[model samples]
Target: MKPIEITDIDVSYGAKKILEAITFHADAGEILGIVGPNGSGKTTLLKAMTRIVARDNGEIRLDDRDLDSLGHRELARRVAVVPQDISIGFDYSVRDVVMMGRHPYIGRFASETARDVEICDHAMHLANVAALAGASVHDISGGERQRVLIARALAQEPTILLLDEATSNLDVSHQVEILNIIRDLAGEITVVSVFHDLNLAAYYCDRLLLLKDRKVYAAGAPGAVLTRENIREIFGMEMLVKPHPLTGKPYVLPVYMHQSSAGANRRVHVVCGGGTGSDILHLLHAAGFTVTCGVLNVLDTDYGTAMHLGLPCVAEPPFHGITPESLSGLRKCLESADAVIVTAMPIGKGNLDNLRVLLDYPAKPVLFYARDHSTRMEDCTGGEAGAVLANLEARGALRVEGAEELLARLSRDGSDRD
Candidate 1:
């Protein structure tokens, strides 16, 4: 199988240009993903590869042969496309629909040969659609239809498979199943897909080409292409990029509107570490409270989440105990806050100073989340942490069962303050 090279391609509708100087190569046996905001010409670029949309200028070549020079049948034999929308006017059995992929090799007046039937059957099984072979396409679910279409493309036996949002209609399990199939076939058949779900693209694609304003914004591996800065610039939205726990690939989460009028004047300071503060910070920020967190290690997950949320944070260096300067900063935040929350997090010598700060701020309304304090103490610094927590409890600090109750208490406190 040879690569499909697109060079300096330009496509326009009358005077309106959709793509310009779009250059990239779909190497043999690699999955290249196209990702960008809507109207960035993802679909148009795919159309140019299959010659479905004429390029006003530039060349698209398949194995050094110009796509324009290849006859229809020859092109179809080498390239198979699964469009984003699949609309069938007539009700056809799944097997019959898959057989359509063998059209390039069949004569107009001839019927499918035994080998064609064999290929179709194998394709259906590979797509996990063998059970649906006898069912009418109109009677199946959207996800099942998507798999059926993929089977048809597989039956084509083309060197290159182009999918435009192929998994967009499927449920979570079906999406995973389809992507698993595509990932398995990637090294044997070149797969070029456009994906709206950045995480899925990052997981499955060998390389990514990001588009913006009808031009290449970035092109490289997923890590290089899908950065916090790049996504913000291209999509005009704030997103947090984290690694997938299982695959360790880049996963993106968009920041949604969570501001609340009820919490407009409330200020809360959180003393948490070891990832326990992340959910509390998120909840407070969403509820419209001015939230600040302090004395967290620089590399802690809580610090990272606070940074992503644009919250004020007082962080010390990684692997270091809290310093006097950081403690002073934390004290300032506590002085300005109307309430304080201490999440149930494992304490060590490095963060034991945080508990001491809570004990000192006995006059302020403090909510101690003690549900997991025992478990957290058992993991680290049990003696010192348990003693300090007892001191804070004796100093009139309120005890809350969990985050939900803490939120309710905070709401009541805010009302009382008002």
Candidate 2:
């Protein structure tokens, strides 16, 4: 059953309606993620629920009781809110700040009891900030401080916990740590968190609320809320949604704009594997380098990346064997190109022919970016291409150190030819 509910809630700042009758609920033991682009009123919703922003209309209820009906102590005992930002106007010990969470239980004109102290200590330990307990709040890192605030909320032992972009400023590791911690607290507390990281929300949240045009555009399980069309419409950008490799959750990958080539005339064949080939194709298109590739098997990350960019890619079906016909197509692409690039993908049985095709085409200068070492070559393929690349280096095939160097040389040389 839902532990907290927002019913047609509206809030206004002077003449502006910050929230437009927003409504949603948090089920008991469920992690609900509210995700939206910046200025989408995510923080405003959190504030409205806490009664920090007086709702101009509608009602908020907690476990069947209207939030407006609850007294300060009653609300404090039931709901714990970790605001988007916490400013320590005056320096205070971490322990003292966490102890503030025990305010609802304290008797008037009385000090903290042993039980309160124990709860504070446990909260500090749970947040992994026990060592910082005695330190001043101003002296800690932003992530640490955020954890401290969360710990304080946990100490409150509320039935519902609200977090506003709690992991926004933290690094990847810390974000994961905090997310895992929130996920672990699932059965004990109904967590409603505002998340800017769509990927993280997809992985962790049981349900997601995608906000757009001042209302809930979609709300359901992460998979439902994070579809390709929903993301494009709401976020105002094109993206590829795939399943996470590890967790099987929906993964959001934003598509970027590619610059088209200045001239419509020349086709440049790119020999790319892995993700290294994507940038080259993009730059080539911007500079009007007619780009085509062969031997990149379907399901290869590089192939998928290329297809995502709308490049004319000749992809072979995935298999243990690379067909001769595919090799012929690759050779044809090479022959048609005014220039070629051999991105550092390891030579293997499936793609050794791709490297051999480059070696065979000595007429065109092949810019080999040695980004990946020979050891990265997963396909043994008799070690012939590795030797061939070394031989080509000795024989004057250009060997560049990085992608940038390759692009700089290409832009200059291609400009001169035009």
Candidate 3:
């Protein structure tokens, strides 16, 4: 059975409707993230689960038990919440605040036992707040206070943990630390968190429930749910969704670029690899050019960049040499292109055809793009690649340095958009 399930949930704030027709389930021992824009009812959903806000209509079950069927103390023993930056009006020590998590288990007339103290101490250590146990919560930094809240939640030892932007106050380093701690506990404790940062959600959450306008927009794995179209549709903004370097998970990169029609009708095919054409692809695509790239290996960074920009690319399999089919595809891209730009990527036998093929397009305007003076094409093919490059340059292959100059020259060439 799912650890938590909410079906057809509706919530309202007074007469104002907040959430509608929300349905999702969190698997046991998994981290499920609830993410969306402001006023999207993320916080309200959490409150509904905790009974802090009444659900207008829905069924919420915790481990097969109806949420309403559980008593207050029993519910506390089953669930815990780590909220954003809560204020401690009274001067309670970190230990005291964390110890409060154990109150659900203690008898009404009884005091804390040795085992309760042990649980609190272990929780503090797990949260990296052991050293601050004796410090007043008010005296600690905002980030430290947040960690104490995590320790408190851990002390509860609840089967399900809910977080409302719990790490919003922590710096990147501390945020990672806390997330790592939480992720380590995934197989033991089921977590449902409200995440503001899409990248973090992509990296951490096993499954995501995306809300748009207070309704369930998408629900699935991070890779499937955080598509470029979904982000554009939900947030009304365009973002590049690609694999992160460290984790290989989908990472969201906002396109902080303005669109122009300067190259509106222009098509430019880029010949690049080894990350040499990443920015060039982005630059050309942003400048409103219909860009195509290739002869790139599927595993190449430039290939990744081209895919991110939604450019039609000619790609070969990893470690595979240029195939006849891909070369034919490359020829098609060049034949219809107004211009071709080749970056200063390495030249080896596997990709030597990428440069040699340029000789066939003598009439096409060609630019040998160098991102900087220090990085030029290295001929690894015993001078054959260099000779081909020399031939292209001889046939008027202009060498353009830097993004601005390349853009300027392409703008001039691509003015005939028709």
CA lDDT of each prediction against the hidden true structure? 0.88, 0.81, 0.91
Give the per-residue lDDT digits (tens) of candidate 3, residues 95-182.
9999999999999999999999999999999888999999999899988888899899989989999999998877988788888888
* Best model per TM-score: 3
Q: What is the model-wide C-alpha lDDT for candidate 3?
A: 0.91
lDDT of 2 at 239: 92
- Top of the candidates by lDDT: 3
Clashes of 2: 9
The weakest ten consecutive residues by lDDT in model 3 span: 409-418
lDDT of 2 by residue, 95-211 (tens): 988999999999899999999999999988888899999999999988888888988998898999998888887899989998888888888899999999999999989999988
Q: Candidate 1: minimum summed lDDT over ten consecutive residues — where?
A: 370-379
Model 2 lDDT, full chain set: 0.81
Ranking 2 against 3 by TM-score, winner: 3
Candidate 1 C-alpha lDDT tens digits along 1-418: 3578888999998899999999989888999999998999999999988888889999888867899999998888888888765888898999999999999999999999999999999999988999999999999988889989989999999888999999987788988889999898889899999998999999999999999999999999999999999999999988889888888899999887566765677899988877878877887898888999988988899999899889999999998889899999999999999998887777788888877887666679888765443534333775877888778778877778766788889889877876
Query: Which ranking of candidates, highest lDDT first?
Result: 3, 1, 2
Model 2 TM-score is 0.82
